[model samples]
Target chain A: MTISWMDPHTTSKESRSCIDCHTDPKALGLGAGSLVKIKGSWRLVPATSKSRDRRLNIPRLDGFVDISGKPLVLTSRKDLRPFDAAELKRILDVGQCLICHKDFDDKVMKNWNSLSPPKPCKFFLKTR
Target chain B: MKKRTTYLLVALVTIGLDTDSTASYYLGAKIIMGGNNSVVECNLAKVEVAGSNPVSRSRQFIKTGSHCCPFFVQENFYMHPRRRLLTLAILFFSLAFHSLFPCTAVPPCQAAAVDSPSKVSTTASGQIDMCLSCHDERPDRAHGRKVLGCFSCHLGNPLTGSAKLAHKGMVLNPGELYIVSKTCGQEGCHTDQVKRVKKSLMATNRGIISTLRYYWNESKDHDADLTVEKLLKSDLDTPAIDYYRKLCGTCHLWLKKHTLPGFLAEKGGGCTTCHFYKPGVGKDGKKTNHPMITKHIPMKNCIRCHNRSGRIGIAYKGIYEAEGYGTPFEDGDVSEGQLSDGRYIKRLEPDIHFKKGLICIDCHNQKEIMGDGNEKAHFEEQLEITCTTCHDGRQRLEKIFEEDIKRPKYPLLTNLVKKNGNFFLKGKKDQKLHPLHRFLDTACRHPVHERLACQACHSKWVPQCYGCHVVSDKSKDQLDKLSNKQTPGRWEEFRSFMRYEVPSLGIKKDYKTRQDKVVIIVPG
Candidate 1:
């Protein structure tokens, strides 16, 4: 009898703090990088100079896809995808706001999604 | 004297004696309806005539009971050939129109047999249940031989003496959804529950199939004609459908018990899938007499099939199935972190409910699991409980306590107890009283937090499979669990990467509530 097993996904219980998902580029499927603003545009500064895979010629295994949604792994499903450039920018822009506004009760953080809200962060306007 | 005779007939009807062979059932009804003033009583075990001023021997009829006389009762009656033929014609018409006038007060007559038992073969209702003669194993307290007997759940001809005749239409497992109406859904039994469970998502599997078919571009929308019940009937084959039949079909309630191989054989026996519990032998190696069939379902029952797919079952208990590298060999030996089904797992922090030892049924009530007789399309639509329902202390705590009161008791849900003029929900499994704290309004009253689902912030992590490649080989044959036959096409899936991390966030627009909520999204 041939004994085989299959379960592609499982989870641990240690939860992510606010900064782990919001600020970290690797956590958001953008690879290991530091987010910085250069000339009114957000640019990812690579943390490590890693070599590409010789066989597939794709990015390293740790990363799923780049900020532009160009897949590093072979994804056959149209529904299963990584964050696109616009989505990545939107998430990182919030990360900038979170740096100054640590607490959720902050007036600027409370009305972040509202239309005529307080703009406390100078970095948010640069991305917009 | 005539009034005494009328009372005996009324007592016979009230006891629900199936005296159709004695012809008293129809005669008693006819006499009661006609309001006959004349006293009439049959001779005990003999065909004797009764005159208009019949002797007050109606007490003897009551004393002799169901095994009384087989005489036709009429004014100046005798055992004549033409009179017997007329009685037979009346019997035929009564049988035809019996349901029109329902016997509201009468209990359903238990199946009975002739040959008087020398040893053991009689139910509590004084009926000869021939099933107990051969298969007389002691059942649980709730479904004792004296109470339900063997004939209640397992429908068969219990009146017959011959084994062949008795076993003619015997159902092996009455919990199977197709024949549940004849067994569990019997008039005075769980008729309403059976009706509701048939429409439940667990039996129908509407949401799972619809989402899969929609993702595969086979359907325009997620609400399509794809359900487990529909799939079992049709022989249609598509890429997504074929994959679903071979893989995902084992979890639903329609799957027959003992049909599949290995661990799968234990899954999906309708009501018994969740409710059946077989106790182990005594510590002294003595065999236990009974197996419990109860509403108090354990965590192991829910986790049997729920360990796969979403992996919510395992996740609740802090067990994570990890990659197969034997993971950081300790003490000069590979760690034995394998499941009985041959999967390697690592320990993680369990859910808050699991840490406190609350079982699945403590929060999830009958309505959420069995459904409310509505044909819902998804699990979210079927599920009624939320974090707010329990912890928020504002929404559904009172309703949850009321639902728990209805369950059968041996081991009661001690969680929902009133202590010192205060209602507190203790953990059913752990027996520890958990404090229900309302959401802290100091930090939670922000506008951004208003539209956020609890799981968006609180859920630790979700399992992520980046690229899952499923390859189906048409040359090989594989066993279909639903059909129980080996058909063409063997399928296998290989995942490129697996990771556990913070789930991606997405907007869920609830059209019914008119609320735009941010919820955690796990990519399929």
Candidate 2:
């Protein structure tokens, strides 16, 4: 029997919400940070606290996987590993779209792929 | 001298025991001694004590409807006038005592006492069930009164005239798992099925308990040696076990049906949970027909318990349980879109299969619902049929073996038939022949969708509950479902950010197959 150790990701009340898996960098397997769009591409902005785990070679508290998709933590199961960079980018792109689209019933999302490449949203253009 | 005294003592006790007859005897004596007009009033109760030979005259009164007075009248001939008066006073006192406390007397028969003569019935197995004397309604065609008698399903004394003896070991509902062996599982009837059903995950609740324990970190793996049966025998309190007992215990087959309040009362019998035909009440609010045991299960039976947790039962029917604020108030009042359990819901597009009149049983075969006599670790492992099973790219029904039809795990044979050289599946609920449509060529051949499970795109929306907080308050005591005792450590769950939208995509890799497939994932 495993001892009563709280994996904050699962057991704690402050555990990640369902959306956090798509939006949060840590949940996407890129160590604790915020996803910021620089130029036209998504970039991972690492947290200011630079404390590192020398053993795993990533940030001590937040590192589950690096941006290249190599696992930093010992995964319990072989089948269930963190999202790779490509998979993370696809999910984050949708998360970014959801900021303005709000729901799937939006006309743009109904035939999203049929349309040409999306132009930068009003918020993204303002930030630029 | 001793023999005379013994006879006198017996006569006095007999008068006391038979109160109705003693009352008649007192009235007869009073009419004889007092010469009162009550003789005309109490003519029916008059027990004539002739001045002839007392022994023969008492026998005459018995033939003439004397309640009881033979012994007293026979003894009265030898006793003096004064002693007779004393016996009358004793009889009067006994009559008063019987009237004062009628409940203390031997109870009258309570079983349905038919005014007509007893009806005799012989079953197919050649046993006479006396229950046919009153209850003669034939059940289903299979379990007819002429075939499996009332005693076969309902065990009671079948050879007795007395109602109490006839109903001695009677079971009100024989489908209860506790005493099913003597009824549904008895020697020649449904024995193998009863055995398999008891071991099924629905009955044992093994998978649910083990999976919860694994998620709570109480177990190393999802496959744990925990079951509802074991918990019922002996309780082991951990966070997961406690939470499951308090919340998820009602939907198992081990529960006695109709014990819970409200619509839940119709749920969770061993066999009747799925088999029993639940009749509805008339407009006058009275039962129109008796509930019969049947193989043709209705969708409502599945929906009764499946309407919570996954909420798939209602989701298939286009009912989405909205958050409890009861939004979109009707006429300044709460919304009318509410479930029987009082959960607020909204209308949405139902599943295509449901809109086309397909039911849960049409997709989930008997093996998926009822186990194939194997103890599986999870529901997915036990589930045999998939979307590909029916909607194959090959454009034909899959090969169904003879053994599959015999054991009947693959029930598609019963419903699936070929007509005019075109394959069709008969809908289990609607009894309509639905054409077997193969997968579209474009979708089947698409390279990008190769790893995707059908539900990834086909499933429009899934109910997503976010930030579920389970708090275990040790100070309070909660009712443990397994033990049925108030145990310490109350567990409460709070959920917020409920949304029904396009599901998040996740990859589920089968380690054995080494195939990673994309599937819908919802928050726990």
| Best candidate according to lDDT | 1
Model 1 interface CAPRI class: incorrect
| Candidate 2 total steric clashes | 0
lDDT measured at residue B302 in model 1 versus the true structure, 0 to 100? 92
lDDT of every predicted structure (CA atoms): 0.59, 0.59
lDDT for each residue of candidate 2 in B1-524, tens digit (9 for 90 to 100):
12222333345556543222222213223323233332233342333434322223334433332344333333321223454465545434433443353432233423323342233333422234556666756566566554555766787655444466467678878888888987888655677788888878888888678767776778887677777777877747677878998778888888888676666577788788888884565334555454578777788888888787667888888777787777664576665578877889878777777887888787777766878888776566676777666667334474643334565644644676667866677898898988767665444434434666666556666675544557888999977655556878888877645766535444567433668876555555
TM-score, every prediction: 0.72, 0.65
The alpha-carbon deviation from the true structure for residue B237 of candidate 1, after best TM-score superposition, in angstroms, is: 1.2
Off by over 4 Å in 1: A1-16, A25-34, A43-91, A104-118, A121-128, B1-120, B281-286, B325-336, B394-421, B511-514
Which digits, one per residue and each the tens of the lDDT, describe model 1 over residues B106-196? 3332222234233324343223355777775565655655445576668665544446545656888788898888777765567898999
Candidate 2 displacement at residue B199 in angstroms: 1.9
